[model samples]
Target chain A: MNINRNNYEAYFISYIENELNNTQRKAVEDFVAMNPDLKNELELFGATKLEADEKIIFADKESLLQKNSTKIIAWKWNINVWASAAILLLLLGVGWWMMNQSAVKSHQFSEEKINVKSDSVKSSELRIRNSELIKTEKHYLAKNNFAKTKRVENKNFNAKIILPETIDTAELPNSWTSRKKWNEEHEIHVVQEIKPEEILQVQKNVAEIDTIKAVAQNAISVPPTKKTEEKMIAQIPFKTSKNERQILKMLAWASSKVLGKETNNGNFDVSIGFAEISHKQALQDN
Target chain B: MTINDYNFCVTAYADHLFRFIFKHTQHEENARDVVQNAFEILWKKRDEVEMEKAKSFLFSVAYKNKIDQFRKQSKVNLVDEFSAQTKIINEHKSGLKDALEKALNTLPDIQKSCVLLRDYEGYDYKEIGEILNLNESQVKVYIFRARQSLKNYLVSIETVL
Candidate 1:
């Protein structure tokens, strides 16, 4: 701790800074007092210790802090906003999916209801037609016994009516009915001498009946046999005398040519007959 | 560090950091720039810097920026130094404080920073070394040399007076 002349520079710095203990401080003071040359040097070194100027101050203190905090807040806010937007989009997607599912379900339900209604309407029509057909057959059976039933074949008629060999008719109808019904039952076999207009009308009525029955039955059911029967009946028009039938057949054939081309299944024979009549005058001119 | 701790650092150490940088840089705008940059760095790394070590961190950052500024202005400083010398020579005799300020400009940048940190801020040799990125012995030597130079400059001025 003794401050010698050789090591006095180190002690002088320490002593001026008040870093020395009491014993060392006293030793340095004693040494400086003894050496007049080192005293001025130590005083000059002390003058270098400058006080901080009050004018040298940071002016904009809060701006840096404010800018930093604002950036952090903005980053956090952006993350929150994006998360909320994503959640909202997900909710909208789920809602849209649910709505689409309900729409499909309602559409199927309505289709099923329409099918049910159509089936009921078709069944009622079939019942009424079947009853009428049975009554007509019974009346014909009674009349077949009273009259001498003649079996005549017409090649033009495609439907072959195979009658029973003997009619065991316990019932008899002696009264006469309308000519239209009689004509319908026996025209193709016995009464082969009908007017051309009457024959054409009969063929037209037959086509219309077939069309109505086929449409009603085929609307919901797929009975292949009924469809074939409808087509055959529609194709075969009633026949008369050879010359008259030939003229009518020629006329029918000519009219049928004007019908649009037949379907692939040949199911449009009825349209051919009407097409033939409308073009008859043109045919005669030709 | 929390917000409150960061604010405390700003309030407590801003002026001290500014004075330290100003002494080294000698230009008010450069010193202010260094102080602001240091605070900005502190705020960005607040989570990593401890509340107690914030003052040390600010000083270290400011010291580094002051050196960078010096490097950028090195060419300009050479020209300015001549003008500054002429001004000092022609100026009227001021107090010891003005003489000390002129004397500080004569020291090298490292020596000036070391001496300023030691004398103005009262940082010990180890602390000064940490701020200046030097070893304790290097900081000690720089401060010693700076003080000797200041002493010589002051004595010559007094002789002229």
Candidate 2:
């Protein structure tokens, strides 16, 4: 009954495992068979071992078993849906910008045509107003000529020339008095017929006024006044027939002070006159 | 090995490996997943695995898979439901079974696994060593210590009673 510690340990484990050599296995079997204490110990060990194993083996069925692949597939679907939503949002944003740009372009396109039409209508109105003013001027000139011819025919010219009893013409300038006396002595007769000489005179005046008015309109969009233009023109380098070198020397000196060292012969500054407020102001400045 | 060889491995070892993992993990679902993943990995690498060594291969795969699962789940520190489970089983136990279970849960994980492989599965020292990734001597020591711990705990409970 007394087994050594080492042998007992070996036998204890081997006996429990049922892995002893034939003879050794039989010996331990016989010993446990005869010894009740050893048998009881074996039984307790066996029971404890089995209970522990059973508890471990008693796993929850749901936790151990793999669930269906549906949950994982659903996660994949979530990523796909979000990606599609982002793409859709980007497309919508681009489409909205394109639509707004198109609308603005179309609005500007229509506005340009309306502006062009309004400009043409304004020019036509100006032409009509000019013609009306010309017609009124012609009517006033014809009536004055008719009245003057009637006075000459009725011998009433002297009666029309009746002077004031007192003369205090000192206040009037000599230029104004001379102009008035000339007008009284000679009638300015405008012939109703289309005379070639009269047409030539009118054409010369028209050419001057027309060119000046065109220049004035062009310079109205610019900054300075007509006096500046005349001053600039008077300062242009011109040589008389007498001494070209002297004129040139004078011009060079003047230009150095005025036009600086811009001595290039081909370079010329053309000055165009532009009017400002009134005829009286124009004469006063001259 | 072809997929057929892989499938054969699955049919042969899946249930056994699942049962083995179930015993250790004590959760049927975790056991199933561990086995399935082990087989899946084996299937993926069928070309590399020898058909003859399929059992050891599956067990090793299952072992690694189970360990990884245990470690991952441990991160959240799932409340040790084992204590509550022992409490419930304790109420139903008429005798030493209650004391034995409480003592078993108290043992360290390796020692408990070592004892379970030896006693319940009827594995020898070498077999337990292979299952637990321990040497025979280490397995022996673990089992002895585990049994001594259980015995001490049970005796202590008796003294208290």
* Top candidate, metric DockQ: 1
CA lDDT, candidate 2, residue B144: 69
**lDDT per residue as tens, model 1, B6-97:** 88888888889977876666555666678888888998899999997899899998877666756556335432332322222323537777
Q: What is the lDDT for A191 in model 1?
A: 34
TM-score of chain A of each: 0.30, 0.24
**Top-TM-score candidate index:** 1
Model 1 regions lying over 4 Å from their true place: A67-79, A86-286, B72-93
Off by over 4 Å in 2: A5-10, A29-36, A51-286, B27-29, B68-102, B119-124, B150-161
lDDT of 2 by residue, B31-85 (tens): 6568777777776777888898677777677776575556444333222444443
Where does candidate 2 chain A have its weakest 10-residue lDDT segment? A120-129
Interface RMSD of 2: 6.8
Clashes of each: 1, 6
Tens digits of per-residue lDDT for model 2, A53-106: 332332333332333558788998998999999999999888766555543443
Enumerate residue pairs that collide in model 2. Answer: A63-B29, A63-B30, A64-B28, A64-B29, A64-B30, A65-B29
Question: What is the C-alpha DockQ of each candidate?
Answer: 0.24, 0.07
* Clashing pairs for predicted structure model 1, backbone only: A255-A276
